[model samples]
Target: MTARDEILGRVRKGVGKGDFAQRKIDAQAWLTARTRGPQPALAGDLLERFRNKAESLSSTVEAVADRGAVPAAVARYLAAQNLGTEVVMTPDVAALNWIAHGVRGTARAAADADRVGVTACFCAVAETGTLMLLSAPDSPATVSLLPETHIALVDASRVVATMEDAFALLRAERGEIPRAINFVSGPSRTGDIEQTIVLGAHGPCRVHLILIGTSS
Candidate 1:
């Protein structure tokens, strides 16, 4: 038989044996964490330090206080990159006035090459310095993935301590249901074979984050 058939036959045989219980327990243990520790005070100092560190690691890092607070930052970025008004706007971004900045927003279903993609983040992690996006009705999954340049507006209030914290928040909101959740760390990068890091391998080459901070 062919290699594919052999693999399928092995899978079928494995299923027939019903060896799923052990694996399930192992998976649960891997995901579940039981910990008791003192919670550190999350303050502006901490966030600024985190932002500084992230900037040091990454060549590109932009920060803002609120969603509405930084329309000029968006304009500056677009002007610097020379992106036009034809931008693919996701419904998730409610605060930013795209038209005011001379940007044409579009629904997720009808995004095209001419349009730059705009989307909102469900949560931003301060630990790994990543942005988390969930595939909800307003935040269509494609906006973050398809465009040549992706501009994400992250509210500082939504920024969490760690990836574990983000997961906890997600579990509280989503429950046990499995859905498309993307965790983007910087832009899309690949350093395979030749070992030279290259950006925009399968996704957007440029990822500009607008960190929108707010009072708690």
Candidate 2:
């Protein structure tokens, strides 16, 4: 037998494996059930809670009317921050005419020197002020990680009351998980040295969120 097969056989023998096909069927059934554990009681409006929590985490947030207005809002933010007009964005928002707003958009993974990276979040958790991002062909993980500034476009409708709710939505929509799932709580910070918090230690120093839709 091949080395891989031999190793697997030994492992199965030690573990006393039954029908592998049956085990896979069981796992699929468990996933489809969408079972959830206990979650904290989140009071008040979910959107308001999300905003408050995100702000507390030092993430800048803006409420825009709709998706059509996102490009203009993003442009305004970049100008106000004195950032450049060129930005790396995800393929999901490629159709938007960013050039009209004086911002050149490139749909690809972020590079080390990239100043700004824009992406649409899969969902936001209100309880912890966390952004749920699932890496896919259109949404790359590097867009939110390898940039000085990470700008996220989140639909207010996708904001969940808790982390549990977010996972439920993911299971319902995706059925299977993607290669990478990122939960961004705030700007990357580290207090390892002298217990002094330093931003951009491992990732973006700034995280800006543009909330869209009527609920926003």
Candidate 3:
């Protein structure tokens, strides 16, 4: 037997299994019957709320009119920050016309030496200003983690109300979950050093978001 079978056999023997398939059904029923607990009234414009919360978490947000303007926006942000025009991107965003805008986008994994990474998030959470990324062949986890500067190009329509909404959307859309789901809230930071907060301690120090589907 494989390692999985071996471990599961031991579990079954220990637990004295009796209709484990029914248990699965019962678990699904329980999940379906579950209701959300009390949460804050997230009233008003979702985009405004998301932008405010993202900025509060140290993430810079920029709104563009449409997807066609994304490459130019990326170029502008890099130029302003003095970060080079060369950025690594996920395969989903690699097909963009980066060359026309004088920016080079490499569809590959990012390294520590890589300065900026351009990625499109699966969705952006308005509640906590978190970015939900479902990892796939086209969307690797390293592209967003290793780089010093992370530039996310997200559609404004994909911004959800809460963390629960994000997960609900995931379940409704993707049948089989991706292997890795990354939720990025601004840039990586830590406060372990003498109770003082430090940014870029573990990941990208700068997170610049290009929010599409809105007026600039």
Error of 2 at 207 (Å): 0.1
Candidate 1 lDDT (Cα, whole model)? 0.72
lDDT (Cα, tens digit) per residue for candidate 1, span 70-136? 5667777888899866677677674567678766666664344644677888887776668888887
Ranking by TM-score: 2, 3, 1
How many clashes show up per model? 2, 0, 0
Better of 1 and 3 by lDDT: 3
Lowest summed-lDDT stretch of 10 residues in model 3? 13-22
Which regions of candidate 3 fall more than 4 Å away from where they truly are?
1-26
After superposing candidate 1 on the true structure, give the runs of residues whose Cα lies further than 4 Å from its correct spot: 1-44, 56-59, 110-115, 176-178, 214-216
lDDT values of the candidates? 0.72, 0.91, 0.91
Encode model 3's per-residue lDDT on 1-216: one tens digit a residue: 899999999888777585788777877789789998887789999999999999999999899998888999999999999998899999999887899999988998877788999999999988888899989988889999999999998899999999989888988999657899999999999999899999999999999999999985
Model 2 C-alpha lDDT per residue in residues 1-216, reported as the tens digit of each score: 899999999988776585788778877887778766787899998889999999999899999889999999999999999998999999998898898899999999889888999999999999999999999999999999999999999899999998878887997899888899999988999999999999899999999999998545
Q: After the best TM-score superposition of candidate 2, give how far the Cα of residue 45 lies from its true spot, in angstroms.
A: 0.6
User: Which residue pairs in candidate 2 collide?
Assistant: none
Q: Residue 78 deviation, candidate 3, in Å?
A: 0.7
Model 3 lDDT at residue 92: 94
Determine which window of 10 residues in candidate 1 has minimal summed lDDT: 52-61
TM-score of model number 2? 0.90
